[model samples]
Target chain A: MTTTTAHMSTNAATLSTPSDREIRVERIFNAPRERVWKAMNDPALIAQWWGRGNKLVVEKHEPVRGGHWRYVEHANGEQHGFEGRYAEVTPPERVVRTFEWDGMPGHVILETATLEDLGDGRTKLVSVSLFMTTADRDGMLHSGMEGGMNESYRALDKVLASMK
Target chain B: MVHYSTSLDSSFAALADPVRRDVLVRLARRDASISDLAGAFEMTLTGMKKHVQVLEDAGLVTTEKVGRVRWCRLGPRRLEKENEWIAKYQSMLEARYDRLGEFLERTRGEHP
Candidate 1:
């Protein structure tokens, strides 16, 4: 009785329609919600998988509202640090936090990760990252690279036109 | 990084205003004099100049003095790299989730 709409995703995670100031990513993990939560909250497990392919070490992880979290990754002989503040932390359900990449300095994004039980042993995770502005979000999309901003600028024009 | 981000902040802040965005849109289509921008926006010369000043500060637009008029045009590389940084991290996040799934499976096998 899986009501999950068929997403045209070839990978485990599906990054859906991204808006001007937000990105929506969803993934279904073949584990219970509690297990999934523990895997994310536990610094030991987080260090193992948080880096994608880089070496990540968790310097601090405080899993409570108003708690602070920091982690550093070493890659190519350079250390990159990331830190955030937890806005809300509800076990096995939802967590809201602000994420900032120290590499970029002032760019910060507020993210919310929500978990839903789909019966049996499957859990669905949806995470949304909200940027401060459309340009910020667009900048992330263009991060570390170069591309024309005409499309995004047009989109920004539409957004601004609608707001007026 | 501080200087880079501050410029981006200025760019975003400049684009946040509807009038400023419209002025950008107009300039993107063609180079315009400050007077032309002011005329299109139905704003005063000083008002439009302020918007242009913000855009110039962000490096989103550039202006040059042509005789008694100032001609403004779009910046050379507009937000091209901004999307790359975000896109890179997005793939990183996706990879992390994939690894997490694998880790969870291995843990299950180990305990079960």
Candidate 2:
């Protein structure tokens, strides 16, 4: 991580409708829908990835409609906690949740994630984070989203394989 | 010194702001002069300097003088430190899964 040779791809203009605090990261996994869904639903499987390499403690995880989940990521002695309630849970298809974290008052996000089985045992995960306004979305994007998430997705690819 | 808060707190705090993160993002590609950075923002140059100072404090960027212009480049170390800290948390979960997998395998073998 200390290597510091970093470059960013500013594809902000490519987004269909750029929201102020929205963060979207799409990943195509070389696995079946069921397996992909398992990775997303199971906290054990999730702990392997999803956090971009942060050590996560699953305080609660009820991955069903109207269920709530809370977790903390510990790093460098500081703790980052996030909690949310699930709005929808259709296995191997889609899940919607309300996401809120520390420092940010109010959730400001009604997130919906769609899992599409693109045939051939491949699944595409699209996460849409809807924030209060474009400024909040832009704020998140600008605030280390590119670097943090890029590193996380890379780690997720490896975790999926190790688990399978 | 933050004896054990993890090295990423400062970096994360610095990046909590969009303006500071923008400064770091710009430095991700190449170093830019103060004016060049100020040109990219809607705020005044003084406002931009305040933003850059946050990045500087977190060790994500470094500014230097080359004649009348000040040059800034991506510090890179702060990110590496932050990544290392975040990766530790992920590693913890992965290890737990390993134990669970082993337990499941043992149970399957014993039953079947």
Candidate 3:
């Protein structure tokens, strides 16, 4: 494994309808649906990539209906925590959960992820987040979380490119 | 932390309805009065006024009262913040998905 880089680039195409009730993000991965689902559900694998290269530690990951999960990310000597509960979970296909950033308690979002099998060992992932109010949905959009993630991706891309 | 201005929420809510969105598109191209909007949409004057009120509350439209006539125009830079906010998230999601792809590629042999 290459050392994680200090900067990251972003190329994610996230979209939120003007409805203010939901935000949908879609992407295609060069892996089978089952593999993509497993990578998302498995705590061990999640820890490796969930934090955008930050030192992520999974405390619990129960990818089953009514189950709960928690993970912490250590960045620059500070630990950030996130936790959520599963609303629905169907292996290799779909999972719905409630996500909340511990730093901003009470601001919870219902997130649903669906994996679609594309022939040739590929899969398309669609994740949608629903908020209680337009304000909450807009809040997440304006949080600048996306900007930070883009930076992390750029840095990670550089590190991976160097390995090749 | 997630934080959005109250006006942002109002703006989105105002834009949610098809009629309101059309109103915005019209205003974007040119200014019009409440009666003009009503006539264009085939809506009642009262109905148009309500819609205009919603847009004005959201700062999406500016209304000026000239004598007894109120002229309406698109609010300056009204959609800028919302569009920027959406664009950032769209790109961010793309990057995250790319990482998912990388992780899958690296762990394929191990998993399967």
DockQ of the two-chain complex in candidate 1:
0.16
lDDT of 1 by residue, A126-145 (tens): 99988664566557777843
What TM-score does each prediction get for chain A alone? Answer: 0.73, 0.68, 0.72
| lDDT of candidate 2 over A1-164, digit per residue (tens) | 11111111211111222432454545455556676677667887666554545677888999888899988877778888878899998887999998776645463467787888998866666766665544565679999997899999999999999998
User: In model 3, what lDDT does residue B51 have?
Assistant: 92
Better of 1 and 3 by TM-score: 1
* Candidate 2 CAPRI assessment class: incorrect
lDDT of 2 by residue, B4-112 (tens): 2443667766754545655665576578988888887555778778877777767777789899988888764545532332223223223333333333333332321
Comparing 1 and 2 by lDDT, which wins? 1
Quote the positional error of residue B30 for candidate 2 in Å. 18
In the order shown, the candidates' DockQ scores are 0.16, 0.04, 0.15
Candidate with top lDDT is: 1
The C-alpha RMSD of each candidate to the native structure, in angstroms, is 18.9, 19.7, 20.1
Candidate 3 C-alpha error for residue A62, in Å? 2.0
User: Which lDDT value does model 3 have at B112?
Assistant: 68
Write candidate 3's Cα lDDT for A59-152 as tens digits: 9887778889998989889998888899998887999998777655666668889989988787888888775545665577699867888999
Candidate 3 DockQ vs. native: 0.15
By TM-score, the best candidate is 1
lDDT of 1 at A103: 68
